[model samples]
Target: MLRGSGVTTLQYTALTVLERRGGISAAQLARDSFVTPQAMADMLRALEQRELISRSPNPASRRELLVHLTEEGRRLLAEYTDAHAAIEELMLSGLSRAERAHLRSSLDGAWRALRPPR
Candidate 1:
């Protein structure tokens, strides 16, 4: 559904992570997004080329580079938020509100269970 938005799935994943975490190192972004370091590097290069994200040396750790979303990136994400919601609504149309809530809770629990111990 977000294909025409000029953002790939991996790019969107990275953006979502940045949106939640504010700014973080590229490596950390890769880890959070569940992508290999090399794949994350390539995705970051593309995002940077699109002016959707910026990279700069981390002030706290010069050895690491911090990645952040730009205004354009945020705007794109905001635009797609409604589209995503609509898709979810359509997908869950057959389910009652309570069922949807229960499904969401179950999915959240499953995700939490799948994550490694922090």
Candidate 2:
């Protein structure tokens, strides 16, 4: 489904993380997106080639490169938002509203618990 939209799952995940966190270092993005540093570097290059993201040197840390989503990236992400919502709706169609809420809460909790401390 995502492939048809020209966005891979990893790309979508990275885009969403950037949307939520704003500009952050490539290393930080890698950690947040659950990808290795090398993988994130390659992905960032691909995103740059697509003009979906921009990277700049961090003033605070010369060694770090801050990554940010471009307007094009945000637009693509918005387009996918509706598709994701439709897919989620279909996946959760069998559950009641309350059950869905509980499931969401539990999943969120698990995610938080599993993430490494900042």
Candidate 3:
């Protein structure tokens, strides 16, 4: 990946999490991503500065802040997801659709098996 693409990975991950879950906290992100609280704080600040994330006080917990993706962030994430899918399709062009599905299932199963129990 190029220098610019490096930020895309982090941005995309954060955007996906926010989009799917609605909102999350910096501490929750630290736990989920296995990063230090400080690291998560810095990352969140960077994302907010880019206008890709919006932060607000949590309604349930005044002390905690909720992080959510801005509309611009959602658009960027959609584009990123489409580009990623296009790349995957190009890479798997040699494989049949069934083969691709099987591979995806196997990989997803392995990932789930390795995840920590809830």
User: Against the hidden reference, what TM-scores do the models get?
Assistant: 0.83, 0.89, 0.71
- Model 1 off-target regions past 4 Å? 114-116
Q: Is candidate 1 or candidate 2 better by lDDT?
A: 2
- Who is ahead in lDDT, 2 or 3? 2
When sorted by TM-score, best at the front, the candidate numbers are: 2, 1, 3
When superposed on Cα atoms, how far off is each prediction in RMSD?
Answer: 1.9, 1.5, 3.0
Clashes of each: 0, 0, 0
Q: Candidate 3: misplaced stretches above 4 Å?
A: 1-6, 30-37
TM-score leader? 2
- Candidate 1 lDDT, tens digit per residue, 1-118? 7878888888888998899986898878887888989999999999999999998888998888899999999998998998878988999999998999999999889867865687
lDDT score, residue 45, model 3?
Answer: 85
Better of 2 and 3 by TM-score: 2
Per-residue alpha-carbon lDDT of model 3 for 1-118, expressed as tens digits? Answer: 2145436565566667788875788877665555678978888888888888898999999999988889977777776676777877898999998999999899879866755677
